[model samples]
Target chain A: MSLLRVDDLRVRFTTRRGPVQAVDGVGFTLERGEILGLVGESGSGKSQILFALMGLLPENATLDGTIEFTGSGPTMVFQDPMTALNPYLTIGLQIAEALPKGLDPATRRARIVELLTRLRIADPGARIDQYPHQLSGGMRQRIVIAMALAAAPDLILADEPTTALDVTVQADILDLFRAERRDHGRALLLVSHDLGVVAGLCDRVLVMYAGRIVEEAAVDDLFARPGHPYTRALLATVSSLAAGDSELATIPGAPPDLGLPIAGCAFAPRCAVRIERCIEARPAFRALGPGHRAACHLTKTPGTES
Target chain B: MTLLSLHDVSVRYRLAGGVLTAVDRVSLEIAAGETLAIVGESGCGKSSLGRAVVGLTPLAAGRMSWRGQDIATLDPAARRDLKRHIQIIFQDPLASLDPRMTVAEAVAEPLAVFEPKLSRAERSRRVAAMLDQVELPAAIADRLPHAISGGQCQRVAIARAMILGPELLVCDEAVSALDVSVQAQIVNLLQRLQRETGLSLLFISHGLSVVRHLSRRVAVLYLGRVVETGPVAEVFAAPAHPYTKALLSAVPIPDPIAERDRHRIILAGDPPSPAHPPSGCVFRTRCPDAIALCAEAEPTAMALPHGGRVSCHRYEPSGQAPAPGLFKEDPLGTN
Candidate 1:
């Protein structure tokens, strides 16, 4: 069985101005032990999908979707380690509480230390007694991951876990995830705006834009052959050391507001190769290859034309 | 000519129990129209250094001189004038901007403070023109920051920072919070403005790719101290410091083939706390090439054969660093 399945997911919020269709329609699946990436810009609804599944939306929000994960309650690693962790609680108690109940105090302590060591936290013994406020941002982030993994859940849902973190720290976090997948074979649904993180860590990717999945493919195929213009534009902006005097290729306009009604393709306004049909009609998500799909008129036929 | 010079600058913050020195003794210079990137892991003091330059944080020690004058000790009138010449764009535009104020009002406040003599009509016109330069539509001038998009709000922030035609701009993780496409837009806008205005830029960011694309020179910081500083091309091509090599290799490149083949120099353990920084060298706790001298005494900044400087015992005479060619070539290929 697939690790998780999400179908026709929709999320909306009742704002003072109007109703915001935060997530129009998003659908994807996660196989066992798979690392699937949800890539999008802010307000593109990538993070919303995770929130929708976690059922953590506010009173003003309404969700319509099916998140089928039969194993157990999935764990979540939110963005911003500073705010995600509680300031008042000690790291040991927080992580220990996440463990299965009925364990002896010694086992709980040992398990917490093991989890901390897995996150590459030095002095786990002493750190267990410390509070969240005492650790650095990097160590705190690792603590956040440890808390998430404490339950030994089969699936992990992370939202922008590595965004804005330094390269060394980010690499360490990525390494931990890779090790988890290798040693335990736990499935992960990672959301991030950084293309580098997705390119390096994810096995498959789902490109989201304005509350919809614009493209989906295996990691290699997506990077090698991006089908959607939005994906191509996003990939082009991934600056490299070799970029010399050349201007970064930016998408012309901003993402459409989710509050107002979006007619037809949400990305039509900013797309470089958008056709007349793109502005008038929403394109169907069609298969471009065995495991690749994109919701673009140009990509409908696939390899035929740009 | 050097537009700004910082000598042994340090920024310290006082906590309840102790004094936390965020930025250690660091010195550097920026030429007019040049972009210098400050990069490091979190808590490495890149932001502190940037904040100190823009006067947001007071210097605990050392001097930041602009045009041969100490910025911190300048006269009140001179300081106010200096504010016009030096502007800053923070990381979060939405948080930085006043929620109650419209885009035009927020961008116009700087002009009102510095050039109060301008008529309302002239002020509005200049605001509109600045918006156009940042590529934000004039129609949204009356809209609140919440009503506009994040990318648009960032454009407004850039517009406000550039309205004074400042000689130097400090971008403190300016585009780090934005989406990739939006980040690219702001990066391009900043580059375009720099080209048009010839303004010196102190670009503080952890995003290496953006740094590589924007900066002429780059400084790698570790535990509030600079481990390496050099020309962008030379540093990335052949990093002299072990910290620099690890930092460059740590960044994930957006290429699948390379990702599979590349040998990442993954640093172990979390970064050491700045409050209890290791004795002798700040980076000695994590430096892969640390020798006995690294733990016994501090290594001063030494000029490299390339156009940069590095602080590492490996470069000193009689120093023995066991690891040689320990790092694999960066998969991004420093071409």
Candidate 2:
């Protein structure tokens, strides 16, 4: 059975200008021990979907559809480690704040130690006394992960976990996540703008654009053959060291303004392979294969000469 | 001939505790119209090297010659004049640009710096043309930095830098802050601009991928020293340095399936403090290939049999044989 299911999730924010449809009819399910990558550009609404699922949406924002956290409540690890943890709070105290109900102080303290050790934080005894600022960026992020894991939740929703970290530090944090998911059988909903992170960590990828799921596929199939033009454009910009010889092709123009009602496809303006039907009407997502799907008029017929 | 050449250049900061050598005895050469990328994780002195080349920072040691003339000997006014031929683009556009100045005024400032006697109309025309070159709409001329999007602001920054048609452009993490999609656009723009203007670039970045895409040749720095330098294709295909191999192994590929199967060369610890780098080989502290000799003496860059250079005692012919962990099988065919 799927561990978490977000069905037809819709999130809209009311602003002075107008209502912005941030996540429009987004639906996906996460199975036990599976990692799904939510990939998109800034303001593409991937964050909003995660927020809506966590029931952390702002008062001005309205959400529709069901977010079923089947096994356990999924806790989130935020992007910026600097602001995520309280400066004054000790690492131990901060982690203990997430302990489940009915746990005594002794039990909670033990839980904190176990989590800190499990996350491979050096010197859990001395480290717990230190504050967030006392730790390195990578260590602080691991503390954030440990705090999230203290809940003993079935799943983790990490939003750009390694975006602010250095390359080597990023590699370490990713290794931690992979290790945790493998050992504990914890499912993950990894949201990030870096294609490399998604490519290395995720089992399935759901490409979001202008608040809708534009494409979804298994990682291997998507990388091997991308049916959607947007996905292809995104892959070209990865700056692969091995694939350094090929010239890059960038998707021109900025993403569409969600405040203004989007007519036709959201990626129509920037898509290089746009058809006449793209600008006139919205494209419904069609199942291309067992797990592959794309919301594009051109990609409707696989390998078709559009 | 090399357009810009540095001979054992070093920079140090006079801190309260002691002298901090930010850039240490770094020697490099940039040929005309070539993109030479200096890449490493933060604090490796890539930015300091860029600053030293452009004379933003004081050179503690060595000599920097630009087109056969020593830059350090130039007068303050002449140094300002030198900016016309070599301009710099900082990492953050929002921080670099003056919040008070409009987009036009910012781009025009460089023009005024280079040609103070030019008429206002001519200056505005030049600024407009530069903006056009970067593909920014003319309507943004009146907008302040905060009013425009991040991508547009970066374009304005690039336009401002290129208004004088500088021969050498030093970009320090220019597109690192932008979204992946936006990063590609700016990189493509820079490539086209370089092609048309034949501008040489000193691109400083921590991102290996960006360096691979934008650089004709690559230099890997560690602890304020160059560990490897060579053509991008040759070096990336078969990196001779252990540091370079570890760095290459860490780049996250876009496809998850391939990523699952690939072996990552995970370094055990954070890089040693640059303030007090390890004795002998700077990388010996964390290097898997470290031997007794590695900790006793520093390694110098030696030309590899394969096209490129590497700084490692193991790779040095005078040194001992290559250790088991010292060398990696080339993922990219050496041939």
Give each model's whole-structure lDDT: 0.84, 0.84
Q: What would the per-residue lDDT of candidate 1 be over residues A183-249, giving only the tens digit for each residue? A: 9988889998877788889999999999999999999989988899998888777742234436667
The collision pairs in model 2 are: A199-B254, A199-B256
- Model 2: per-residue Cα lDDT over A1-306, one tens digit each: 689888889999999988999998898899999999999999989999889878899999999988877877689999999899999999999998888778887887788888988887778989888999878788889999998888878899999999888787799999888887899899899999988788888889999998999999998888887878888888866633235444465667888888888879999998888888899999988777889999999775556455
DockQ, all models: 0.63, 0.53
Lowest-sum lDDT 10-residue window in model 1 chain B: B322-331
Q: How high is each candidate's TM-score?
A: 0.93, 0.92
Worst 10-residue lDDT window for candidate 2 chain B reads B323-332
What's the number of clashes in each of the models? 0, 2
**Which lDDT tens digits does candidate 2 get at residues B166-274?**
8899999998999887887788888899999999999999877777778878999998999999987667766778888788878776666657766677776667667
